[model samples]
Each structure stands twice: as C-alpha cells, then as structure tokens.
Target: MDQTDREILGYSRYVVLAAAFSAMFIISPFEYAWSSMSGHIGAIYGWSPEQVALMFTTFIIFQSVGMLPGGMLRDKYGPRWTTAIAGLFSGVGILSIALGPSYPLVLVLWSVGSFFTGFIYNNAVTTGNKWFADKRGVMTGLIAGAFSWGSLPFIFPIRAIPASAPPETFFTVVYIMAAIIGGVSIVAALLMKDPPSGWKPTGWVPKTKAIARPSEHNYTVSEALKTGQMWVLIVSFVLVSSAGLAGMSNMVAYSNSFHFTATAATAAAGGIALANGFGKLTLGTLSQRLGVENTMILSYIVSGLFLFLTIYAGMNRSEWLFVCAAILAIFFWASLFSLFPIAIGHYFGEAAAGGNYGVLYAIAKGSGGLYGGILSTMLITQHGFPFAITIAGVMAIVAGLILIPLKYSPPIWKDEEAAAQLNARAAVGRR
Candidate 1:
C-alpha cells in the first residue's frame, strides 16, 4: 500500500511462490507414480488392488482432514510459521514412509505425510493472494497451476519400471522417493511466507479492493458456514470435484486399463499434470477477464466432455486419441483448482479466504480423497473406464451448473464492512 510496503512486496513474492511451487514438485509426483508401484507393492506386501487403492483412500482422508486446521493455522498465524511447522511434520512422515518396515507402518507414514502436505497448498494460495492482491485470479491460477509440479518427478520413475518386476520393489523405490522428495520439500518450505503488496514484482498489484475486499465484519469459521452460499460451494464442488480427483488419482491406472504399458500410462498421466498446471494458469487468469463464475462454468463443461472422450478413446484403444482426450481432460480438471480459491476470494474477500476456502476444499477434496479411489476401482471392475469416466463426466456438468446460482448473488461482504471485520478477527480472542 505505502511505497515501503510495495517495495517489500515486490521482492519477497518470488520466494513465497517458489516455496509453493517446490511443495507441489515434491508431493504431486506421488499421484502419477502410484500405479507404477501398485504391482510391486502388491507382490511384496501381498495386498489386493482393493487394498492398494485404499492406501490412496487413506491419504485423501487425512489430507482432507488436515486442510481445515492447516488453513486456520495459516489464517491465524500467517503463512511463514504454518508452513515451517507443516514442513517439519511432512518431512518426518515421508521419511518414515520411505523407511517403513511393514505395510501398516507404510500406511501410517503416508497418511502423516499427506496431512502435512495439505499445509503447503493452504499457505501457498494464501500467500499468493497476499503477494498479488490486484491480480488475484491470475496469480492464484498461476500458483494453483503449479500443482503440476507434483507430476514433475514422477515421469522418470513411471518410465523406468520393467513390467515383470515385482510391485514390492516399487514400494522400496517410493520409500527412497519419499526421503528425497520430502527432504527437498522441507527445504523449499523454509523459504515461504506471505509478502506485502508490490514487494516482489514491480508491476504486480493486489486484486482491487472491490474484488477481494475483506469483510469489515469478520466471521468466525462457524459464522461463515451459516451463510446460504457456503453450502452451494460445498455441495457443488463435492459433486463435481470428486470426478476430477477420481480421474487425477486414477489417470495412470485408467490408461493402463486401456492397454498401455505402465511406462506409457505414466507418461500420459504426466500430460494430465501438464494440462492441470496450464489449466490453472490459463483459466485462473481468464477468470480475471471473464469473471470467476463464468470461467468456472466453462472449465466444468470442458473438463466433462474430455473425461467422456476418454471412454471413447478407450473403446477404440487409440493411443493418440486417448492421449488427446486425457490432455484435454487436464485443462478442465486443473481449472477446478484455480477457480475454487479465486471464487472464495470473490465471495468471502481475502479476510477469511484462507479459512473459508480451506473448509470448502476440505469437503470437496476430502470427499474425493475417499470417494474417488473407490469409485474409480469399482467402476472399472464392474462396467469399465467408459462407465466410470462417463459418470464422472456427468458430475462435472452438474458441477458447472452449480455456479449458475452465483450469477445473481452478491458477495457476502461489501468493502467497508470487510475491512472492519478482518481487522477485528486479526485482533484478539476473548478469554
């Protein structure tokens, strides 16, 4: 706001963004690499696909659970300390997972790692909004898009495997991966914090006070839940986002089901990562111009159609078609990430965006954390990818429709009220 504050913001934002991007780089790879270890893990641990899938299910459960508290911590204490504590916890968990002596230990370690990883995204989004108040949508999208950083490390591992090798070896590799990935992520986490406006980039501007005005009237997390629109966001995203997560969590396996080798399937999954990152950046920025609600609707429509296309591609067993369909699928899928945060900023203002978005994210992603793994495996086992992907696709269409009601609705807080509210919440608690 002031010249000194602007300069500080201009310089410090890069460190903040890097911290977020790095976290994504470490944790995201696991999504793409999961299937590669499936067969090997199954052999060594002597588990079934249902069991292995449940491993992911557990990760989701913990991650969803962690988001609310993580966001609240970030909201309460600010970005730096929250991420630092989380990183410490995440590093320990991942290390434990990598060194697991038994299957039960692996589950415990992985769950802990997943919960800590949840801390990074919450801080990253919160920090990004703090960094670029003027360009909230675009900036948020860019940061959200960087979630593909998760996919970056996975390409190599997914490609290196020999089909005949046991799944248990894959587990060992993941364990090693857990140590390496977790280590780097912990280091990255050290550099993160919320920057003052105009601190890092010269031209960077905070989102207009109008677009992201904090409520002068602060709402407790409980108070926020009492609003009418909160349920809309929760129910809508839970239905639609579950489909996206289902696809993301299962992309590699979904491709394998179509007859591709694990390596090839992994590569295709990376493409989804690429699309996800790009979609977040593109759609997030686009929301700035088209409006968050409109952009979200479009993302839903596009993502749904592409998901259905995967079914068609599967039936034909056309690698190119499948690849194309999957690539397109990422575009819409990634947009969901950006839009959710941006919309929260729009509806709630930045005052409680961290906590507000955290709750919605908890519901949407948490449910996916459970529902997606089950749905993906069940659908494929019973009706197959066509049936599975089609169902998800329909949910996306409905998810897009969820935004229709927001068009006529105004933000829960106006500008003058927002400033007062945030100042109050930022103040102190009564004994």
Candidate 2:
C-alpha cells in the first residue's frame, strides 16, 4: 500500500457500513417476506402448493444468477450505479407485479426484480470487505444479519392482512415496500464512497492468527476459478446452505405440524428469523477467535444435531424443545453469510472480492435453493417431514466434513512454496 493510502481515512467507514446496512435492511423484505404472501397469492390464483413455491424457486435461481454480473458491476463501476439499478429493478418490477395479470407474467416480473435485488445485496455485502478489510467477518455478519432480520417488522402485518383482504390492498402494501427499498437504497448508494485502493485503518495492523489473512495474490474472477480450494468451498457452501435454506423455507409449516396455534407458529418462525440474524453476528465474531474453518465445522455439526433433535421434540410433543432446537439450527445455518465471504476474501484477495464472492454466493444459494426448496419439498411429500429433516441434517454434517480439507491447504496463489510447506505440515498433523 502506498504511504498516502496507509493512513487511516477517519471514521468514514462507519458511514459506508451504515449505508450498506440500510440498503440491505430495506431490500431484504423482497426475499424473506415472500412466505407471508405465498399462501395468499397461491389461493388468489388458484395455484397448487408446488406452483406457489415455484415462485420462490424462481426468485432464488434468478437472484443467484444475477450475482455474477452484479459483482462484476460493483468491481468495475462501484456500488452507486449497481445499487441505483437495484432500486430501479426492485422498485419498479415489484410495482409492476401488482398490475400484471397472469401468474406466469408475475413470475417473469418477479424474477427480473429479484435479479436486481442481487445487485443491491452483493454491493452491500462487499462493502465490509472493501471498506473494513480487517473486520470483514464482523461487518459482513452485521450487514448480512440486517438482511435476515429486516423482515421481522413486516411479517406480522403481512400475515394479519386477512386472506379476504382485497388483492389491490395487498399489492398496495407491496408498492409502498418497494418504494421504501428503492429510495433508501438510492440515497444510501449516493452516500457510499470506497476508500482508496489498498487502504487500511491507521495504526491497525493485520492479524494473521485466529483469522485468515488475504490471499498472497489478488486473484481476479477467472484466476479464482482455477484454484482447487475455490471449488471445495463452493461445494461445502452449497451443501450447508441447502440444509439451512430448506429449514428456513419450511420452518413455519413444520411448526404448524406440531399442532402449534397459528399465532405460535408465526411467532416461532419469527423467532427463528430473529435468531438467524444474531447467529450471523455471534458466529461471525466467534470466527475471529476460533478461526473461520473451526467455527464453520462447529456450526454445521451443532446445527445438524439440533435439527435431528427437532424430530425428537416433535415426536414427544415438546413445543419448547422443537422451537429451541429449530432456532439454534437456523442460527448456525445463518452464520455462513459471514464465514463464506471472509473465506473468499482470504482465498482470492480483496481486489476481486466483489466478483469472486458474487459468483460463489450465487452458485451456493441458487443450487441450495434447489435442494432446499424443490427437492426438500419432494422429500417431505414422499417420506414425510422427519425423513426430509434427516436428509438436511445429514447434508449439514457432510458440509462440515468437506471443510476439513481447507485447514490443510488454504488458498495461497502467490506463495506456492509456503503453501506447500503448510499443506505438508497439515497432512502430517492429520495423521
């Protein structure tokens, strides 16, 4: 880093973080709030459960696909244009959904809106790595946590809107939400300013122990794709995310199956949503002390155990156990938002953090939504909820196992000799 860029640029980072947080919070309802309207929308259109759920799948798939271009935009053009475009697509597309006639038309419009939302999401997330490189884990957790928890305020109001409420009223609310998301995001985007390249906080030294350091070389998107470690992390992320996404999509219905009242089921789902945010913050911070790899391993193992316990709780008619276990399972699952991005920055370096992490996040969540949404739904139909839960739990455990190789061979593109030596030592330690 040049001497000019070496000095602390003051507290401007906090401003950037706040902007990212605000944008994430406003845009979040687009994804997390879908469950609130899914049943109603389905009923209104006389669609089957699979058809209603397909909307969510469509959202996830297109949003996931969008992250690649979104990240590339953030890398090349910065957050301002990316987020502004996000505002346009999300706000206008959602508004358009209210007027669209056919279900197929709604799906197409929502996907377009969802795609731009990815731009908002990636730009917001990349802020942490770009601005607070030293505190990537914590910042990413907080920002992503906002995305998770942002839906809480709307969940009840959305649910309370009786199924009999006019469709116009329902969509009117969506319009207001779309406007808020777009407006806040645009203002926040204008407020955002990236620190000069290679910037670091004044007097802040990089930490090597406990937390992983930036990669030895800053690999571009193409370069990052070449590394074996990148592919390993990708697979691990997909597996772990699948388990979590499945749980998230079905938590309310699962709770209802235990015969919990409508209010209680919603409460439980809301609690899990809230816990999801805190889990990101807690585990993300924990990674600083426990090492990201170790934290992820612990998170998956414990999450899987709790998910299995959920089955036991259900069989015993233990609502408390079921709720508690479900919350904890989601807590750990949500931690991936923090862990994966930090790993990406560590593996590929911050220069390409936007694009590299974008592609990784897209693939993981897109594929995960497939497993979690469509496949888990099929499993639930075929073998029952317990069987579905068991599969998800097993997937979590496997994700942890996959990450075990990472400790042995961290990605280090610039220093082959050093990485090899470390790999050798890790291999010996394994024996």
Best by TM-score: 2
What lDDT score belongs to each candidate, Candidate 1 first?
0.70, 0.81
lDDT (10s digit) by residue, model 1, range 339-418: 88887766665666678888988887778656578667877788876777788898888888877877667445556557
> Which segments of candidate 2 are over 4 A away from where they belong?
1-11, 212-214, 414-431
Q: Estimate each model's TM-score.
A: 0.85, 0.92
| Residue-wise C-alpha lDDT for candidate 2, range 49-102, written one tens digit per residue | 787777777778888888889889888877888887787788766665575458
Q: What are the RMSD figures for all models against the true structure?
A: 6.5, 3.8
Runs in model 1 with CA error above 4 Å?
Answer: 1-11, 95-101, 164-176, 180-182, 195-220, 261-264, 414-431
* Candidate 1, position 299, lDDT: 85
The whole-model C-alpha lDDT of candidate 1 against the native structure comes to: 0.70
Provide the lDDT at 193 for model 2.
Answer: 61
lDDT of 2 at 88: 77
